[model samples]
Target: MAEQFNFSSPPFDLLRAAERERLSEALSVGYYAAGETLIAAGSAVPCLFVVLKGVIEERGEDGKLFAQYTSDDIFDIRGLFSGSSKHVYCAVEESITYELPASVFHQLCGANPDFGRFFQADLAAKRQLARRDGQNLAEFILTRIAREHLLPAIEVSAGLALGDAARLQLSRGADALLVRQDGELGIVTRTDLMTAHFRDGRSEAEPIGPLAHGPLACVELGDFLFDAMILMTRKRIERVAVREDGEVVGLLHLTQVLSLFSTHSHVLAMRIARAESEEELRGAAETLHTLIATLCGNGIRLRFIMQLVSALNEQLLERLFELLVPPALRSRCCLLVMGSEGRGEQLLKTDQDNALILAEDLPVEQGLALMQRFSEALLSFGYPPCPGGVMASQPAWCKPLAAWQRELNQTQLEGQPEQLMRMSILADASPVAGNRQLYEGLRQGLLRFAQEGERWLPDMAAAALQFDTPLTILGNLKTREEHLDIKRGGIFPLVHGCRVLALREGLEERGTLARLGALKARGVLDEGLADNLAESFELFLQLRLQQQLGGARDGREHGLDVARLSRHERDLLRFGLHAVKKFKQSLAWQFHLESR
Candidate 1:
C-alpha cells in the first residue's frame, strides 16, 4: 500500500475518514514525462487523476489552454464518470499523480452518496454543501452553542413573594426567573427584580408576578446562536427564553451569546455604540475586515453577512455623528446614508455617500460647518470621501427639508440623465440618525414624484439594460481582459430593476431583496420571478464580495476574473447572468422601453 492520501482539500475533503482510508489503499502512483499525453480529447478516461507533484495542462481541441491542474488538484472526474474526455490532458512538467481506478471510483460512488454528489453537484448545491461544511467547523459561532451552554429555566410560582423568589434565584445561581401566572409563563430578569425592589419601592412580600414581563421573547433550543443574537439586537433585550416542544427549557442571556463570539458583529456594534472618541471608533472599525473574513470564510450566507455589516456600519456612522455634532444640531438634521450603505447591501467599507437634511429656517452656514466636521470625522474613522461629492460635506447635499423637497421635484421634472442618477441615489436613501419626520416628509415627496412621473420609469429602467450581460450563447462568460464586470453586468440590472419597480409600486424599502419581496407582495411580480431575481442578485453579490476580498485591483472597474472561478462557480455565474437577462427583458416589457 502507498502512503495515505491527504483529504484536506475539496471533493476529497467531502469524503469520510474511512472512505479516505479506502481511497488511500486503492490509489496507485503514476508518473508522466513532460509533454506526455495523459488523456486525449474525444477519448475515454480510464480513471480519475489526483496530482501529487508537478503540473498538467488541459488543452481544448484547438490547442487553447483550457485549465491547469497542480498538486492536490483532481481532474477528469466528470470525464471518468461520463466515459468521454472533452479536453486533452498533458503533463506540462514531469508529473506524478495518484490514480484512482475506475472500479474503485465506482465502488466509492456507490458507497458514499456525499462523495459522489461532490463531483456531480451543481454550483448552487456545492455552495450549500460548502456552507454545511463551514457550519461543522469548530470556529463557527453557531457550533459553539450546545445543550450545556444553555442555563436551565428557574421557575417560581407567580403567587410566591418577591423575597422568596429572589432567594430561590440566588440559590440556583440564576440570572433570570420564569414566573408562572394564570397558566402562562413570564420572564423577570435580575435587573427587573432589582428595579422593582429599589426603584419601585416594592415590598419583599409583594407577589413576583407584578415584576414579570410577558409575553417573553423565546427561541427554540435548536435555533442558531446567530439568529438568537439578531433577535436580541432587534428586541433590545438582554435575555431570551429557550423552549423545546412548547415547554420552557432554559434562558439564553446576551452575555452568554457574546461569550461564544468575541469578534462577532454584535460585539463590534456594542463597541461602536460605546466609543467615546474618534480613535475608539477607529479601533472598532479596524476589526471589520477580520469580522468579514471570518464570516465569509465560515460560509455564512452573503445576504445575512451584508445585513450584519450594514448594521455595524450604521452604528459606526451614528456614533461618529454623535461624537461630532452637538445634541441641538443633531436633532435638527436627519443624517441619511445613501447608495449601497443606504440600501443595506454594502459588505465592505466603501465611499461615504451621506447627506444632512436640516430642518427649515436653520442657518445654512452652520449646518455646512457641522456637516463638514462630521464628514471629516467619518473619513478619520475609515470611510473614504465620495468621489462624486455626494456627502454631507457638500453644500448641495446638506440642505433644509424644503430644499430637499424642491430638489426632488426639480430632478423628477427635469428627468435628465444626471438628474435621473441623482434621483436613483436618493431613492435608496435611508436615515441612520436624527429627525425621522423630516426624512419621511422628503420620502413622501419623492414617492409622490414617482407616482406623478410614471412615464419616467422607462428611462430609469433603461439604465439597468445599458450593459449587456457578459454571458455567451454557449453558457460561458464573455469576458473583456479575462474579467466580467459582475457589478455592472449582473448586480446593476437586478438592483436598478428592483429599484424602478419599487418606486413605481410606491414601495418604501431600500434594499434590493426587500424591494423585490415588497413588489411580490404588492402583486407587481410573481413569486417565482421574484425568487429567481433574489437568488440571482444574491449570487452576484457573493461573487462581487469574493472579488473584493480576493484583492482585485479597482473592484469597481475590473470585476471578477472569470478564469479564476471554479467550474461550478462559472456555471453559477452563467445561471445568474441568465437571470439578469430575464430581469432586463421584464423591465423592458413592463416599462415599454423597447418602444422608446
Candidate 2:
C-alpha cells in the first residue's frame, strides 16, 4: 500500500521519513457513490481527501458549482481548522480517495512547518507554493539579477591621474572603475588602462579622462539573470553596469552570469538600459508584452512581475529623458510618472500618465522642446495617449515646484469635487529622473496640505464607494455585456480606498499593497482585512494582466472575458470581488461615507 500510494506527491511528499511512515501506516482508502455527499455544508470536516479516481464537485449553499477536483487534487483543507464546511463536497462520479485521519494530518502539519504554511499562507504565498508544487528547482522567472550577487562599482574622478586611477582600481580589486565628468557616466577598465599607456602611448601622469568610455552599457538590477547573460554575450563585454532608480549602483560581470545561466535574449531591461538611441529604446519597449507573457506564464507572481516591469519602465523613461532634455535644464526640473505607472501596479503598456516640475522661477524655455517629444516618443512606442490630458505635454500638468505646491494646497483647502480628481491622480506620483528633489519638495508640501485639510479625506473616500460592485445577491459575479469591467468594480475602489486611508493616516507609501501593510502596521487596519485586501488587489492585477496580454496583438481592451473563464477561475474572481466589497464597506465606515 505504501508503494502504491504516491508518497512523492505534494503535501504527502513534504512528509519526512518518520512522518511518511506514520502517514503510510495510518492512510486508508474510502469509496463514494455518484450523487452522494462526502461532506455536508456546516458539518465538521472529518479528514483530508486525496482523490484516487473519479471526480468530486464542490458547491455552495446556493448549489452553484464552485470547483471540481479530480485525479490527485485535494479538497477543503481549511475546513479542518475552521471546524465546519461552508460548501457541500459531493462525488460527481463513483470515486476512490486516500483518506488521512484528522489527527495524523495535524501531526504532519506540526512536524513540517513548510507544509503547514502552504495551507496557512496568503494568496501570494500560496501561488508561489503552487508554482513550486511538484518541482525541484525554482521557476526560471524568479531568477532575477538583483537577487544575484553584484560586484561593487569602483569610481574615480575623471581628472584623476592615470596612475592614480590605476592604483584606485587595483586597491578596489576591480576589473574596471567608473569615471564621472559633467554629470555623464563612463567606465575605465584595467585593460583600457594598459591600452592607453602602451597603445596610445600616454604617460601614467596623464588624466584618465580621454581613455574613459562614454555611454557605458547597463542593465537594471531588476532584470532577469538570464537576460543579463545575453546582454554580456551580444555586446561582447565582460560586464555591464547595473542601474537602480536611474543611477548606476553595481556591476554584473560575465563571470558571474556564466556561473548562473546560459544565453537567452528576452532582455527588455538590458536592452532598454543599454540602448543608445531613441529607436533602440523603442525596439526594447516593443518586447514588453513578450517579456510579461513569459514571466507570467512561468508562474511568476503578479506583484513581483509588476515590480520588475516598473523598474524596467523607469530605466527606459530616464534614458529617454536624458536623450531629449538638454544638459543645462536637466538639473532644474524633475520628470514624473503618475497614475498606474507611479503606483508600480501597471502590468502592460497602457496610457501615458506623466508630468514635469521645474525649479522655482526656472525658465521652461531651455527644455520646451522636451515637453512634446517625450509624449510623442511614448506614443510611438505603442503607449496610448491619456484621453484626460494627464501627460507632461499638457501645460496644466507641467508647472514650477512652488506653483505645484500652491495648487495642491488650494485644491485641498477649497475641497471642490472636481479638484479632488486631480488630487487623487497626483497622490501616486513618483519621480523617475532629473532633479528628484523638485518632486520631493512638492510631495512633502502636498502631504502637509492634505494632513491639515478637514474635509479632504471623506470627500476623496466617498468617490471609492460611488461605483457599486458587480456581485449578485448571493455574492456571485454579475457580468455586463458578456464581460465584467473589473477596473470600475474591483480595482478602482480598492486602490482609491487604500489611498484615502493611507493619506488619512499620513502614510507616504504609494503602492496599494505597501499602503495596506503600512495601515496594518499603524493599527488603522486589522491583519485579516489587510491580508484580504492585498490578496484581492493582486488577484485583480493578475486577471487584468492575463486578459491584457491575450489581447495585446489584437489591440483589444482588457477585462475578465467572463464567457471564456473556467469554473475555478470564475470562483477565484468571485472570491476576489468579495474581498473588495469587504474593503469598500470598511472604508465607508471609517470615512463616515456610510450614509452616502
Candidate 3:
C-alpha cells in the first residue's frame, strides 16, 4: 500500500513526521455496515473521519447527493474546529474511516506549524470549490475581542432604593445599573428613572422596582463581540448583562461600545474640523496616526473600526465643506468618497479618491467653483490631493446622476482595459452625505451593469489569479528579508476573490468584510470558510498596522518584513498567506482562469 501511494507529495509531503504518525493512528481501520449514517450535519461532535477504506456520500439537508468521499478525501474537520452544531452537509456510507479526534488533531497540528499550514492549504482548496457549488464554504478562523477596556459593571439589588442606586451610579460614574433579583435579573437605568420621575410624575424615592425591566438579556464573559452583537440585535436591547450562568458578572452597553469607537476616531476628526490653521490641521493629522495605533493595540475589530473611522472622516469633511464651500452649493450636492473609502475598509490614509456628484441642472460654472472650494477645504482638513485627480474639483468625476450612470454603462462596453481597471474601484463606492440617494442609484446601476450578463466575473477572476503564491519549488517556506506587502500579496487575493464571488452572487454588501458575511448567509460561501477569510484579512491588517506604527515611532516608513515577524506571528501569517494562495488557485480552477 505504501509503495502504491505517493506520500512524498503535497499535502502529505507537507506534514511533519509526528503528524504523519498521528494521522496513521487516527486513521484506524474500522468498517461500518451498509446503511450506516456516519455523521449528521449540525451535530457538535469532537472528531472528524477520514476514509481509510470504502466510500461515503455527503448529502444536503434536502436528501440530495453532493460530494462522494473516497480514498484520501477528508470530511467534518471544519465542524470540529468551528465548535458549532451547524454542519453544512451530512456523511453517509458503510465505510472504513480514520477517526481524528478534534483535541488530538488540534494538539498535533499546534506543535507543528508546517503540518497546520498543510491542512489549511487543503481546506482552502476545497472551500474555493465549495464556494462555487454552495457546499463546503465555512472554514474556521479564530477571532479575539479587540476591545482595550472592559469597564467594571456597577451592581445593585433589584430591591435597592432609587436613592442608593443613584448614589452608586454617580459614585462610579457609570451609565448602566444591573439588578439581580430573586436569582433572576432586571435593570433600572438612569434614563428609566429620569423619564419616570420628571415626565410621569413618579417620585425618585419610590422603589426603582416599579421601573425595573428585564428577562435580563445577558452574554457570557468569554463570548466574542460578534456574539454580543447578535444578542443585542435579536433582543432589540441596548445593553446585555455579562453573566457567568445566572450570576451577574459584568455589563456591556451599546454606548460604551460606541464610545470606544469615539475615543479612537472622533477626537482626531473633531480636531480637524475645529482647526483654524494649517499647523493645527497637521497636528490633527499627526494625532490620527496615534489613534490608529491605539485602535490596533486594543485589538479592535478592523472592520468595525474602519466603518467608525470612515464615518468620522465624513463628518469632518462635511464640516470643512460647510466652512469653505459656498452655502448654496453645499445645499445642492455632497462630497462623496468612492472605492476603498466608500466601502469603509480603509485604515491607514492612502491617496484621496473622491468625487462630487451634483444635483441636476445646477449652474455649471457655480457648481465647478463650489467643487474647487470643497476640494481646497479637504486639503486643509488633511486629505491629500488625488493623484488621478478624481476629486470633486475635477470636472471629469463630477457629473449629474444621468451622466454618471451613462459613463458607467459606456465603460462596460468600451472594454478598454485601463477604463475597466478604474471602474473596478467603483465597486467600493458609498455615499457619505447630501443627495445620498443619487450615490446609491449610481452604485446600483453599476452593479447591475457589471454583473448583469455575468461578463465581468470571469475577467475579474482571471486578473485575481495573477499574483502567484510564493511557494518554494522545494516546499520550503519563502521569507522576505525586506518587508513583504501583506496587503498586496495576502489581502488582495481574498478581497478580489470575494469581490468576484459577491458580484456573481449579486451580494450587495459593499464592504469587503460585510460582503464575505453576506455571501456566507446566501450559501455562496460556507460560514466557516468565510470566517477564515475574514479572520485572515483582519490579522493581516492588524500586522500591517503594527509595522506602520513601529515605523512611525522610528521616524521611518519601515515596510513589513515577514522574516522579522515573531515566531508566533510568522506561523499565523504562513497559515493566513497559504489560505489566500489556495483560495486563488481554487478561483483559477473554478472559473477556468488557467485554461483561459
Candidate 4:
C-alpha cells in the first residue's frame, strides 16, 4: 500500500531521497471507524493527517461541516505547527490514512534542507489557495510570523527622558515603547526617539512628551492579526499599545506585525497609511526600494511581501477615497485601480491608473463631481495624475456598469491595439473602495469578456512578448551605461506576461507570482519553467528595491546604475536575466510570436 503512493509531485518532488524516506516512514498508516473523531476541535494538535484512502470531514464551531477530504488531500498541518487544537477532523468513512506526527514531521523537515523546501512549497501552495478562497483563517495567514510572542507590560511612562527611554528600549531589544498617557496607550519607538533627538535637535531631557505619539487606536486581542495590522497602519505608528479597559497591557509593534508576515512588510503598510501629506507619501514611497533591499539581504520570502504590500496599498487608497469623496457619491460608486496597481505587482510607485463605475443613470453632474473629487484626492495622496488621464476624472473611464461592459465588448470585437492596451490596464483594476459590488461586477464581466474572446488574449501575450529580456551575447545580463530599468526589461515582462496568462486562464489572481503559479497549476505553464520565471521576477524586484534603498540611504532622489552593480549583484542579475530570457521564450511560444 505504501509503495502505491507517489511522492513525485511538488513539493515532495524536491525532497531528497533520505528525507522522503524519513517522511514516508513517519507517515504511518492509521485507520478510523466511521463516525470516529480523528482530531478534536479546540485541542492541542499533534499531527497532520493526509487522507490516502478514506473520507474525512471537518466541522466548524457552528457544528456545520465545512470541508471534505479525500485521497491525496492534506489538512491540519498548519494547526500542528501553531499548536492550536481549533480544527476537528472526523472520518466520514471507515478509512486508511497517513498520519504525520507533528513532532516527527518537524524533526525530519528541520534536519533536512530538502525536506524543509518540500514542506515550504506545499504550505505556500495551501496558503495561496486559502487566500483565493477568502478563507480569513488567522493560522493560514500568520504562519510566517515565527517569533515567540513577547511577555506582557513592557511599559514606559509618557514623560521619561529620551536617554532613559533609549536605554530601556535597548535593554528590551524590542522595537517599540508603550506609553501610558491620557487614559490611552501611546507608543514611541527607539527610531522615533533617535530621529527626534539626533535629526530634529530635540533634547533627551526635552520631556519624552515631544517624542511619544498616540492615543492608541485599539484592537481586541481576540481580533484577527490583520485587525492589529489595520489599526497600526491607520494610526501611522510603529507600536500599538495593546490596552485592556484603557490601561496598557501589551504592545504590538510594527516589527511584530511584519514578523507575522515577513520582513519586507514591516513598514510597507505603515508608510502608506502615515503619509499625511503628498510630499511625505513621495518620500515614503521610496522606502519600498529599501524594503526590497533588506528583504533580499535576509533572503525573506518575496512573493508574500509583494501581496502584503500591494494589499495595503489598495487599502490605503481605499481609505483615502473614503476620506475624500463625499459620503453619498462614495457609496454610489466604486473606485477601481487599473494597470500594475490593479494587478497587485507594483514595486515602484507609478502614474495612477484608475476609473469609476457608478450605479446606472445617476445625475451626470453629481457623477462627474464625485470622479473629480476622487481623482484630486488620489493626486493629493501621492499617486501622480495619469498622463493618459485614464482616471475616474475622465468621462471615458467614469462610466455606469452597463457602459463599462459595452466598452469591454467593443474592445474585444475590434481587438484594437490602443483599445487592447487600455483594456489590459482596465483588466488589472481591483476595487480600492466604495461600492465593492460594482468592482465585483467589473471583475466578473472582464473575466467573461476575456474568456469569450480568448483568441484576442494571444495578441495581448504577443505585446507582452515584445519586451526583450536583458541577456547579453555571452549569456550575461546586459546593463545600461546609466542604470538598467528593471521595470522595462524584466519586471514589466513578468507583469505583462502574467497578465496575459491571467486573461487566457480566466484566473483572477492579480499578482505576477500568483498568476504564474495559477497558470502552472492549470498546466498552462510548465512547473520548472514557472519556478525559474518566478525566481527571476523576485530577483529583479529585490535588486530594484536594494538600489532604491541605497539611494535613500545616500539621501539621493534617483536609483543606482545597474551596470556598476557589485560582483555578487552582477552574478545574481545575470542568473535572473537568463531566467527572464527563458521566460520570454515561453511567452513567445505561448503567443506564437516570432522572436526578433
- Cα lDDT tens digits for candidate 4, 1-596: 66655666434555667877877787777889999988888887767676778888887777776667666666786676677857688898898887778888777767766545444443224223212222223342443222234334567677788888878877877577777777666667667888987799877776676566665565545444655665555445555545556555566666656655554453666566666654565565556555555544544445645655676677567656755666777767888888767877665566778888888857656677867866776565456788888888888888888888887888778888887888788767888788898877777778887678777777787776665666655354556675666767777777888888888777888777788889989998888778767777776766666666555432122333765564335545665666667777887887777653
List the candidate numbers ranked by TM-score, top first.
1, 2, 3, 4
Q: Which scores greater on TM-score, model 1 or model 3?
A: 1
Top TM-score hit: 1
Which segments of candidate 3 are over 4 A away from where they belong? 1-285, 363-368, 376-382, 450-453, 474-481, 526-528, 553-559
* Candidate 2 Cα misplacement greater than 4 A, ranges: 1-122, 133-270, 273-277, 359-370, 553-556, 566-568
Once superposed on the true structure, which residue ranges of model 4 sit more than 4 Å away at CA? 1-301, 552-560
Cα lDDT tens digits, model 2, 361-470, are 66665444577899998999888889999988888888888888888788867978877888888889999989998888878876786678757779999989988899
Superpose all Cα atoms of candidate 2 onto the true structure and report the RMSD in Å to 1 decimal. 7.2
Overall local distance difference test of candidate 2: 0.78
| Reference-based lDDT, each prediction | 0.80, 0.78, 0.63, 0.67
Pairs that collide in candidate 4 are 42-85, 43-85, 343-510
Question: What are the candidates' C-alpha RMSDs?
Answer: 5.9, 7.2, 14.4, 18.8
Give the worst 10-residue stretch by lDDT in candidate 3: 132-141
Cα RMSD of predicted structure 3 = 14.4
lDDT of 3 at 237: 63
